[model samples]
Target: MSFRDEVEDGRGDLRKPFLHTGSWYRMGSRQSSIMGSSQVIRDSSISVLACVLIVALGPIQFGFTSGYSSPTQSALSKDLDLTVSQFSLFGSLSNVGAMVGAIASGQIAEYIGRKGSLMIAAIPNIIGWLAISFARDFSFLYMGRLLEGFGVGIISYTVPVYIAEIAPQNLRGGLGSANQLSVTIGIMLAYLLGLFCSWRVLAVLGILPCLILIPGLFFIPESPRWLAKMGMMDDFEASLQVLRGFDTDITLEVNEIKRSVASTSRRTTIRFADLKVRRYWLPLMIGIGLLVLQQLAGTNGVIFYSTTIFESAGISSSNAATVGVGAIQVFATAVSTWLVDRTGRRILLIVSSFGMALSLLVVAIAFFLKGFVAEDSSLYGIFGILSVVGVVCMIVSFSLGMGPIPWLIMSEILPPKIKGLAGSVATLANWFSSWLITMTAPLLLAWSSGGTFSLYTVVCIFTVAFVAIWVPETKGKTLEEIQHSFR
Candidate 1:
């Protein structure tokens, strides 16, 4: 029988008829209706609250490291006697590690299961934090940061997939946004801790969340969808029972799983070969384009060099400048979470890019004007105020656009069969672009601050064009629905 006919007839295991070949498949139409009713009941069992708690644990670590690293850069540079080049190398090295981790973790998640991978990812993350807190040398600090990046990369790629797989179709967007929200909260917490306490103390404190998360692993069930793929039908049903909360139509779930596995089995594992095809090329380009745009908008440049930006604006005190930048990032990201779902991804990208382009223009103008100013106090004051406004506008624009959308889109787009691989590629692109941006910003600043902002303005314009051409509206689609879009 055809796939559609089987589906309509309630013969859910159409692809793998043997899996349900026993008495289970012989049940009458009444039995099918009862099973369908049970699935509806089972669907009601999945708790949004539990899923939120599990997903939030991973992003907290991401936010803590991303936000806290900026404030510590000055201290690290001074303590390690880093020249400008060496300091830039530090940022590049972390992204290198993240790129490696993102690629490796996809295969790792397939083998170990998402929860297992999450548990393992946290161990290195906790250790990395502890190492940074006590590091006495540049190499030690670099190693610690590298490990932390690896952990972040793994969690970043995995947690969204896990949450998306487990969440009810209706709630996935909010839960997905929760991951972003937790990251913001973590950023805010790290910023607050860095402001009030020692960097070492804040680094050590960052590891505490892992302690809470490690225990959660035991309670949360594996993705029922994953179990179905393994041909462990019994375990798959059991997982669905626990996750969904009632007995489900195992046949329907199994059929969906069979279709997924059948489709995936036809292709080789993630490789360069996968990108050689016309069908895959567009998605790959879109993924990489988003990554490049995200970095070119100067989000990481701002994040890593926020202190320097603030100081250049005439905040002479180093500590206060770092704290101020951190505060701005925290508040901006918090606002992003609220606006992301409501504004839709495309509109936010367009509006924010416009804002960023305008902000960069202002900065370039301010710097150019500063060069012509005589040693007049009023001129200096005016230049400083303009510079501060420029930086604030840039931060707000970035938080709204580049900061959240890449992650959100990466998690949502692409077929499930290639999600792990596609996500890795996108994430790798993100980290590598971030590395280049961070590594070059200091040199760019020193060479020609006005020229640096001008370059970013140009890139932001390209970002606007790319979004208009390639990005699809994924604002309210289910995972199954999203996969169908690519098909």
Candidate 2:
């Protein structure tokens, strides 16, 4: 079904997801009252812990589903008696399903709060894992995989937004970075576990995160920003109070959120036509641009064909190389989580994009050298090692910034009203680019591995320039402050 159909709320009405326009923060209009800083520090630490724990599950599930098929590929093919072409389709179907989910996610999050959207996503994931575990036919397997993909697509948009909204300004970037860390961790878990478990058991493991999240949702507060936007004043205040701590003197914050919400109340339904305004379109471009460049930088090209890349690098154990890649991703993302708050988003992105570019250039050079050297020569061996180093560098460089920052910035920059629409568009563009890059990667590799990476190198270089020129430092600003900074 189309997203229009999916967006129909339980009340049988299509709730238009609104985009907030103009500078609504209007700080002068709000009153300020200071709460005891020490009291707030003491209480809010525990307050948001549950929220982080729960929301992080979505990313873990994303990683798990992504890493699941890697080790299970042969078993899936053998058991289903699938041809290479059919197996390739099975592997990529998640992207197709993800595109659908990405399109529908904004509206889903709009109708339901961020928490509710996550809860909705969890159902599909749980059911998908169960179906995958129990499947006796290809149809069940396909449906299960698609459902898991759809769930993650929804999770992809919702988790970062949720974290950004609820997190204190000082901690937003670091917390947002956690989402990517969870993704890497989930991927590592799947890869490590897939070695010991059967495909069915691994599928069952995929269900566990959602199982934890389903119950955990109840214990956390919804996004106060979303609550206020819906004009649910009581719940809004309650959620914010809970997030900040009960006695954290939320008067100033409450007034700020109320004013933003009050301004948004008038523009409750965003039509496709409404995006014509420069305000809406500008952020859309930024969000979509980052996502596209993130893909065009060819992170997926490396990921989908890491084994081939390792072999081409003259690595004897392709599996070990792939495992090393996953390990680096997890480590780099952990470092990103620490660095994001300190360095801010823009610098990290510029650095990441540039680093990846240089890394890709090295790989291109190594491959170019490989073409010239005899396979038995010591020079070829050196080039082979260089290729492996370049591959690791590329993955590390990507994990540091490009992997997490685009979604973080997208969540931070878009006003709540337009977040659903713009986020959906950006995410859809991401999935489409992923599909395009994945589809053409083998041909590109065949035509020239050096040339393929050179193309990505150019894109990565452009990404650095883009970040330097266009992306803002969203390090410690309130959501309202960050959105208005774009103005």
Clashing pairs in 2: 18-417, 19-417, 19-418, 20-417
What C-alpha lDDT do the candidate models reach, one value each? 0.70, 0.82
- Report RMSD for candidate 2: 6.7
Prediction RMSDs, each to the true structure: 6.9, 6.7
lDDT of 2 by residue, 1-487 (tens): 4323444544324333222211121121131233443243236756676678789999999989888877788888898787877777766777888888999898788776788889888999999999989988788889988998899889999999999888888888888988999998998888778778999999998999999998887666778888677655555666777677655788988887776666563333567765676877767888889999999988887887888888888888887678778989999998998999998888899889989999999999999989998999999999999988998999999999999889898998887777878788889999889878877887899899999999999999899888888887888788888767766
Runs of candidate 2 with Cα error greater than 4 angstroms are 1-42, 266-268
Q: What clash count goes with each model?
A: 0, 4
What would the TM-score be for candidate 2 when compared with the true structure?
0.90
The global Cα lDDT (0 to 1) of model 1 is 0.70
Clashes of 1: 0
Estimate the TM-score of every prediction: 0.82, 0.90
Please identify model 1 stretches exceeding 4 Å from their true place.
Answer: 1-46, 74-88, 232-262, 266-268, 321-324
